[model samples]
Target: MTILNGLKILDFCSLLPGPLATMMFADLGAEVIHIESNRRVDLMRIMPPYDEEKESYIHQHLNRSKKSLQLNLKSEEGIEIVKKLVKDYDIIIEGFRPGVMKRLGIDYDTLREINPRLIYCAITGYGQTGPYATRPGHDNNYLSVGGVLNHSRLKDKKPVAMGIQIADIAGGTMHAAIGILAAALHREKSGEGKFIDVSMTDAMFAMNALYGTQYLGSGRPPQPEEEILNGGTFYDYYRTKDGRYFSVGSLEPQFRKLLCEALEIPELIDSTFNDSSYTQQRFKEAVTDAFCTKTFDQWLEIFNEDFHGCVEPVLTFDEACNHPQIQARNMLVDVKKSDGSTQRQIGTALKISGVEPTYQYVGAKMGAHTEEILKTYGYNQKEIEKLKANGVLI
Candidate 1:
């Protein structure tokens, strides 16, 4: 059996963070029921690259292995249906802003009253309680406030935007999933559930732990690209002749010697490599110039065939999916779409030696399980019809 075989999750979320969190649970065999309204589909449904075969790429990744139900939470009957589902579900995740869920009457207090053991997780930009809690924001704004932007700036230029939605997926969604799991484990011991308030901004703040520690203990202000391990001179990206890049990290003396030998730069041997004052800048320029002499592929072949060469050729997104090391580790897998065309979906980063991850279900259409989900919540056909007639189940 999968890890979360019997767990049930009520996913009243839209966009990336919350849905991706519940998707992680569903991947491990949780029964995730996604709630939506016919008035509007989740914004992800229209995001690209559109799947011509299935008609939606959003459904392809985010909605995988989950069922969907249409319900107008503003309606009394609709709220009642959700409460009934709460009695059976072990967890509920909502990604609405701070007060939106409470306004809909499905807040943690309301749900916990019905099923005291329910693990309720609320994901928001700033959190449930804070000066900025109610402020409107997104991933970029949250991470920016928390110094995530500092570590990602150019070497001697202004801060640049991060490549991925670090705050959304890494800070918010991943933390939400972890909170849900922790709450589930806590429920097993305490026999009661608790509320989990996850703040994307707080998570972003935690990302600067090391930097903060440096500032607090030594009074050394955080440097943009000067940190020893933040891909500084000794550990940074180098461009190649073919417009590709290779990341190198020859931090220690032995590794530095090996790099110098590989580059045929014998004069760099016995150099004061660790001194960041003057030598670091020169070393950075030397490394950059050395790498510019060859293509990325040439450097890759040289490094992979050698030991103690702490260097890696940077791979593009498409190339990364099919990289030899990635394929060997099974980090990419083919997931069959609803239309029979298979798409390459990212494999779980977790590796369990004994149990292999399974493909529980493909992504479902929007509100595809309205009738089935309502029936499970003890709604009869006539009652469901009446609710639908009243514009409550749309």
Candidate 2:
């Protein structure tokens, strides 16, 4: 009854990008059989801070609603089994560096032969081809190569490492999902599958967006802290006396007036119209000094006085989870495990009018659905046992 109900995904995607992309499809009601291996499992499964059930909390969040099928890809029997599954499932997501899947005999070129309508996507650091395509890289390396880190820093300071994996999630995950859906639409009309090569570095390069366009249009690279949103105007964060920070984004005239008036420094309002660097610096310093006089909570109380300004405190994650606005949006929910225990999770942001998101369960035990999935693929209990004996499924 969901948007992606008929979509079937044979996913070999592990870790962040590919897994998250398929997870989105699974959440929206697609059939996702997550391919895993006993010999070489996903590293996320072994990461620390496991829950009381001894399951990795991170895995619970990422792999929900997908069925897991353990297979030893190095084995011939495993390759045959995967090809059999591909005949029924039309989409595949793989995250190997390029050439690995081709060597394993299930690359997009090979699978498309089995099912010409198969939509195959590869999410990699660089892509299928380039001098750096085979290079080993992580989120930071991709961002560095993409020129994103160059303009997102304060003057004369090394760019701080990000708390989140922006390149992996925003870059790869989003692009992979978008490309697959776009290809799915193409397949709908032409009845032909497409190969998607999602490069995280390329996505980050595209994310440069307005600043990058400005640089190309004007023949000048954007400097750190020189752009309005970066810190050029007084549109930035300021620390209060209590050491907590408040974000200021009062860029519009009306909001700027409200902010200055809330700070009891209405005189600063007139000069805000000037976009000159010197004037911006003076305004920034004045706002900084004013913020230093009050605690973050005190400033928050003043802003809450119907200021209607786009200023707010730099809340911690826990605060954000508890905020009234977030609560009002019904963002938090309790998803169940088969045993009746439930985990509190941030639910989907998608708000389709006639469809609801599915949370079948938190990440299942490794290969929890192996027998169930195999039976659907025409394997009997005896054959399943033989595969387990051969170390084909674990």
What local lDDT does model 2 show for residue 92? 93
Cα RMSDs of all predictions? 1.9, 1.2
In candidate 2, position 389 carries an lDDT of 97
Leading candidate by TM-score: 2
Q: Which portions of model 2 miss their true places by more than 4 Å?
A: none
TM-score of candidate 2 to 2 decimals = 0.97
Residue pairs with backbone overlap in model 1: 38-394
lDDT against the true structure, per candidate, is: 0.81, 0.89
Q: Which RMSD does model 1 reach against the true structure?
A: 1.9
* Angstrom error at residue 276, model 2: 1.6
What's the C-alpha lDDT at position 77 in model 1? 81
